[model samples]
Each structure stands twice: as C-alpha cells, then as structure tokens.
Target: MRILKKILIVLVIIIAIPLIVALFVQKDYAVEREIVINQPNEEVFDYVKYLKNQDNYSKWAMMDPDMKKTYKGTDGTVGFVSAWDSDNEEVGKGEQEIVKIDEGRRIDFELRFYEPFESTEPAYMTTEEVSNDQTRVAWGFSGHMDYPMNLMFLFMDFEEMIGDDLQTGLENLKSELEE
Candidate 1:
C-alpha cells in the first residue's frame, strides 16, 4: 500500500508540474516563411488574389486532396470568400475571406475554423518586388489560442506543425511560378 501511494504521488507530480508550468508561461506563437519566385510581383499577386487560385494551390497543401471547397463573390477582388470542408482532421474545415488587398503588394484575410474547435483569426500574404523577373512572397498567420488550446501548446509545437506546411506551400508556389 505504501509503495503504491508513493508511485501514485510520483506520477501526479510528473504530470501536474508540466501543466502548471505551461499555465504560467505566456508566449506569442508565430511562424513566417518567405520564398522568392521567378515571376513578377503582379504575376504572383494575380495568382494569390483569386479564390480559384487557392483551389489550385490546395492540391499541394490543403492536406485532403478531396476536400470540397466553395467560393463566393468575385474571384480576384476584396470580399471574396473560400470555404472548405474535409474529413481529414489535419485539413479540418475553414473559410478565408479577402478583407483587404493592395494592388501587387499584399493581401489580408480573415480565417475561420469550424472543426477541432470554432475560432476566427487574421492571416495574410504579402509580396514585394525583388526585381523585374523576381518577387518575394511571405505568408503569415497570427492568433491567440484560448484556454485548453493554450495548454495544448505545451505538448504540441505550433511552429513545427504549421511552419513546414508554409514552407511546402511556398515552395510549390515558387515552382508553379517559375514554370
């Protein structure tokens, strides 16, 4: 009985300490990745400004190849929306609305997720002219995780989970643009 009690106490301390530490740890989580495309800024911006282009890019990083997506409003203009549903948890479900656009410079959006939990966040992609035949594209997402999600960050590294996807998607974009 005494040995069992000792084991139980040890187990509790092992699990409880991490959770307690995580609760007190406050940090901002963010991931940013950039890729240089051989295409001009206007050309790259044109590819990203439309919902249809997202559908085409989804083939690379949307996780579920078969996820169904629907678009609303004009394809290349502000107020456009792209919603998606997927059985794959990695892909889950979400919608992105183009809230702002700056010609060939940047695109800002609102991202809402439905599965795993329901939340909305801001996301953006910006492009800068590197030269006449090259452009630099940067994609970024920023948001706060509420409560349990904040706790989950203790076990899961958001940067690891999402950063590679950003890199992969950008690499694919680079290839597509170069071709």
Candidate 2:
C-alpha cells in the first residue's frame, strides 16, 4: 500500500511540473513566411487581396480538391468571406474573411476554424516592391491560445507543422503571379 502511494505521488508530480511550467509560458503564436515574386507589387497585391483568388495558390484549399466553398460580399473587398467545408481530416472546415485591405500593400484576414478544431486567428499578406518588377510577398497568421490549449504547443512543433504549408502557398503564389 505504501509503495503504491509513493508511485502515485511521483506520477502526479511529473504531470504537475509541466502543467505548472506551461502556465507561465507565453500563449501567443505567429508564423510568417515570405517569398519573392517576379511581378509588380500592385499586381501581386491585387491578386492576393481577392478572397476568391485563393484557389490559385492556397495550399489548404488544394488539399481537398472537391471541398465545398461558399462566399459572401465582394471577393476582393473588405468584408468578403470565403468559407469551405471539406470531408478530408487535414483540410477540415473553415472560413476566412477579409477584414482589412491596404491597396498595393497588405490584406488582413480573420480565419475561423470550426471542424477538426475550433479556433480563430488573424492572417495577412503583404507586398513590397523589391525592384521595378519584382515584389516581395509575406504571408502570416497570429493568435492567442488560452491556458491548456497553449500548453499543447509545448509538446508540438508549431512552426514545423505550419511552416511547410505557408512556404508551399507562397511558392504557389509566386508561380501563379510569374506565369
């Protein structure tokens, strides 16, 4: 009986230590990736700012080729929303709404996921002229994860998980723009 009690206490300590440490760990996360596209900043920004144009470069949307999509408002303007439902676990279901647009510079989106996970985040794309015809485009997302949800990150490689997707999307964007 005494040995079992000691084992139980040790097990509790092991789990509690990480949970206690996680409480002090930062909960905010942001992932940013950039690529250079051989195109004018205005042209690149114009293409990206349009919600419907995601089909041309969004890696996630391509994950489920037949994913059902619905839209609201003007696609290239602020207040535009593009929601998708996919049967694929990886693709899941989500909606992205254009919340802000800085013509020739940036476009901000509010991303809300409902299936496979429930969360919301802010995503954006920015374009900067690198040369007379080359443009640098940056894509990223940021959000806060409260308490226990944040703790899961300690056991996961957050950047490694999403970095590939962002890089692929950026590459696709560059290809589409250059073509």
> Where does candidate 1 stray beyond 4 Å?
1-19, 58-62
Give each model a TM-score. Answer: 0.84, 0.93
- Please state every model's RMSD to the true fold in angstroms: 2.8, 1.4
TM-score of 2: 0.93
Per TM-score, the best of the predicted structures is 2
RMSD over all Cα atoms, model 1: 2.8
Among these predictions, the greatest lDDT belongs to 2
lDDT of 2 by residue, 1-179 (tens): 99999999999999998889889987988889999999888888888988888898989988988999999999899899999999999989999999998889989999999999999999999999999899999999887888867887878777767777999999998898887
* Model 2 weakest lDDT span, ten residues long: 154-163
- Candidate 1 C-alpha error for residue 101, in Å: 0.8
Clashing pairs in 1: none
